[model samples]
Target: MPVTHTYNEEHYCKSKRERRNHRMKVGFIGTGSMGGLLIDAFLSSGGLLAGDVIASNRSPQKLARLAQLHPGITLAESNGETASRSDILFLCVKPMEFKTLTDEIAHCLRSEQIVVSITSPVQIYHLESVLPSKIAKIIPSITHSVYSGTSLCVLGSRLEADDRTQLLKLMSHIGTPVEIYEHHTRISSDFSSCGPAFLSYFIERWIEAAVEATGIDHTLAGKLAGEMLLGTGKLLTEGEFTPQQLQDRVAVPGGITAEALNHLRCSLDGVFERLIATTHKKYDEDVAKLDSLFGRDGITRRK
Candidate 1:
């Protein structure tokens, strides 16, 4: 089945040569939800022609659907074919599949090809040791799909300047990409990658309370809570106020807001503190385990 697409012809034509000059032939191994999102962001960013991107997955059916949706993409039969066809490859597989997949495609990857892994805890050195290509590790959040998330990318010391620039440009469309040390990547994941989930938990609690107090429909309550959070996020970005400053601004002296804030601080401190500490501890433990199993070098595990 042919996929239908509408694009700016003039824009594509003018940019075609420029894109060909600088754009990479990209391949994605694993067309799952996250992989699909990456492809979407890349295409939407333009410059790279549709034919420049290829993808391969374990399930041909999944690839077929993706190819149908994006007619410009070539579907590879195997992981090695995907790696060989592209200048840059993204390993979007699960942590358990990392070693096996890398082993399968190692021989196909060229020394100049750049491989970016989104798998948690699997460090860049593990990838470099297994594959001959230059490697990078990125801790990306689910918000990448929305094109407004944060990604903490740790570039391996072995990567060339051109490859690093290409990576930053490719990922910039999805969100703000921050470069950090390898060890800091794991810590960033604890806050930035998993931060969305933590925020969602609080929003869920807020919605539940709103539903109970106002007798609003559960769905409406959820929407309201989400919008509130969205607005708060925008305010935080636009205003120069720190989090503490924002909190102080909301709590008026001798008022309901102040009373509520006091109650929250007094009653919720122990519970929230314990939850945050436990989450960080668990994240560190997972990183330690990956380092033990994979052997760390450029990719330092957080312990």
Candidate 2:
């Protein structure tokens, strides 16, 4: 099932010595929001070079936009082409599109290539049925674009030692890679991937409240709140302080900050519990739908 591929004869790094200097050619299928962000993070962080990458999208305009932003990168005419030409292929399409996308490119994927899925609901066992290549699932975050935060990795049975090493090394350039059990994917993603949006929403509302209460300019309020958040993140990451410890340090006894903290604790008491429950409910529904598509007979749950 290995498909043959041809490269430009005039392309650089063709000589034996130059070939040794060449890096792996990474291909991305479906350059939507997360896919595009991952590509940008890898390139901007120097984890991958533009010339060594090929990307394809369902939308021509999206692919054109990527080419415009990154001049030297190659654009594939189809998903099958992207699958056949790369050492590492990333399937970044939606959860529902996984089956059709994998079916389309399955013949082109070789045992030597590593195929990674960024969609959470499509597990490795589901992918194992279709792709002959080594498979992995990486739940990435928007924060990776800034080369920070955690990315969850769950390696499949086919992955070799070297494959795991190479994948983790690439992830380290963008974010810390935390390998977790299959069952933990949903909860882990909720904290790492969805955490950004949740925090941002909270901050947005926080800023709005300040603007309404004091009649301060909205732009100024946003700048103040944003910088506060940036500084708080730096402290949490670089400083030797747990979140609770930092909160205690800032909210001194009988102070304005302490009063605000007391109010917030009361207001947010059941908020997060409800948030997690709601997210997990939706996740269960999605997994149920996927389960119906891929039947549950042989899927191994790591627990």
Q: Which candidate gets the maximum TM-score versus the true structure?
A: 2
- What are the per-residue Cα lDDT tens digits for candidate 1 across 1-303? 121112222433334467568656889999898788788777776635688898999988889998887897888877877887677888998876787787677767666678999866677767766677788987777877767767888887679888788888878878878898876665577667777888888788887888889888999878777888777877787766777888888888898988988888888868856776786676567656766656666554333
Error of 1 at 32 (Å): 1.4
- Model 2: weakest 10-residue lDDT segment is 4-13
Task: Name the regions of candidate 2 deviating beyond 4 angstroms.
Answer: 1-22
How would you encode candidate 2's per-residue C-alpha lDDT over 78-160 as one tens digit per residue?
Answer: 88778877888889999888888887888777777899999788878888876788999999999999999999999999999
TM-score of candidate 1 relative to the true fold:
0.84
Worst 10 residues of 1 by lDDT: 1-10
CA lDDT of every candidate: 0.76, 0.87
Per-candidate TM vs. native? 0.84, 0.90
